[model samples]
Target: MLKDKMKEVMQYNSILNQPNAQGRYKNYKCFHCKQMGHIAKFYPMDYKKEVSDMKKDTKVQGFKASKSTELITYPKIIHFSTTCMIKDTDLTNWDKIWYISDQINRHVCYKLDNFYNIKEGFSVTKLKNQKKFLFTYELGEVLIEESGKSIMILGMYYAPEVTLNILSLDLLEKQGFETKYDGNRCTLSLIFKDKEVHTFDEDRMKKMHNKYLQDYFESLSK
Candidate 1:
């Protein structure tokens, strides 16, 4: 029943080749935000939805749609993003491309080069296929950036298949950081103790990632 409804909705959304086809779903209204063309469940603002007890099964399970622009149901912990940009910071005109999830559980990262002291052997199942698994591991405390405020993650996981950089809201607050979500505003999401903190910078982290990779590959030749 729901699949049929979703099919009908997709037809309208595909007309303009846009996420939301304007004037297409005029009759559709979101009860949460009182917006048109989508419902509260499909609101891409947070890109979150309800799922089973993923936290109990694994710290970092498979998440979100394959494409950045494809919105779908996700776990409570994951603010599965179709867009690589953070939704909260988009309004401010920041060109940063890293994504921030309001994930209620553990945080997860995409690259091994970006992490240190993390144990491997952990695996994550894909959201679409529970049987398939991707190997990753626990991120105890990783310095995402080596300089310029030095953004760090408290508790996170590493998945090789993941593309976008992700942070766990659960461990972030437990690690002495606070977030402000004004219902829908969700502005200034990260803060250290009392002071406001900005999200991780992409360029700096990329530099650190490259450095790690260079050292790793160099050691292999030894």
Candidate 2:
């Protein structure tokens, strides 16, 4: 039985700061300007803006444009399936990105594998410490596209130690959304579904996620 239901509903918790470098990954935060050391999808300024070119198209909605997100795993029993590569991007392959966070205050988005369909319990995350291993992940919903508009993340969290993919501006301000900021760009306007939203600037953060170190995004773009 799915390995006895994965040993009675999974449970993994043990991460007392394991980043290893760059000042322990600058304590990871950057859900954009909410800053700490940097990670706002690889923050870096002087980005002249230009991603509206998706020319060689590739295959986004079905994923393959690349940066990470091939989903569908099963690390424990469930017949031991495979294929999991988070470190995702849904702002469209401008360059791969999906990291916006208010420190994931209990999920409004969080993905690693399973893609989207998880449910019936599972979610336990942390990067600097906050040990929480309830069901250990399996709640879902993820369909962000931005620019072409589609935002529909209703509660994802299949976090397998999340490599990249976190969008929780304080749990999207508790579901009613309405966040605004201009300089470094950040916009999430109210009640979507028709109103739509997306304004991450820096030319959509230069097409998303670069993975720090361009002189640390040019010393925070000065």
TM-score winner: 1
lDDT of each: 0.51, 0.47
Tens digits of lDDT, candidate 1, 114-190: 55446545656455433444445655445543113345565667654555566655556666666554443332224
Task: In angstroms, give how far residue 219 of model 1 lies from its true place.
Answer: 63
**Over 4 Å off in model 2, which ranges?**
1-101, 105-118, 121-123, 126-128, 131-137, 140-153, 156-167, 170-176, 180-214, 217-222
lDDT of 2 by residue, 9-63 (tens): 3311111222432475567775533545445344433111212234234323332
Residue pair clashes in candidate 2: 95-207, 122-137, 122-138, 123-136, 123-137
Using lDDT as the measure, the top candidate is 1
Q: What C-alpha lDDT, on a 0 to 100 scale, does residue 170 get in candidate 1? A: 56
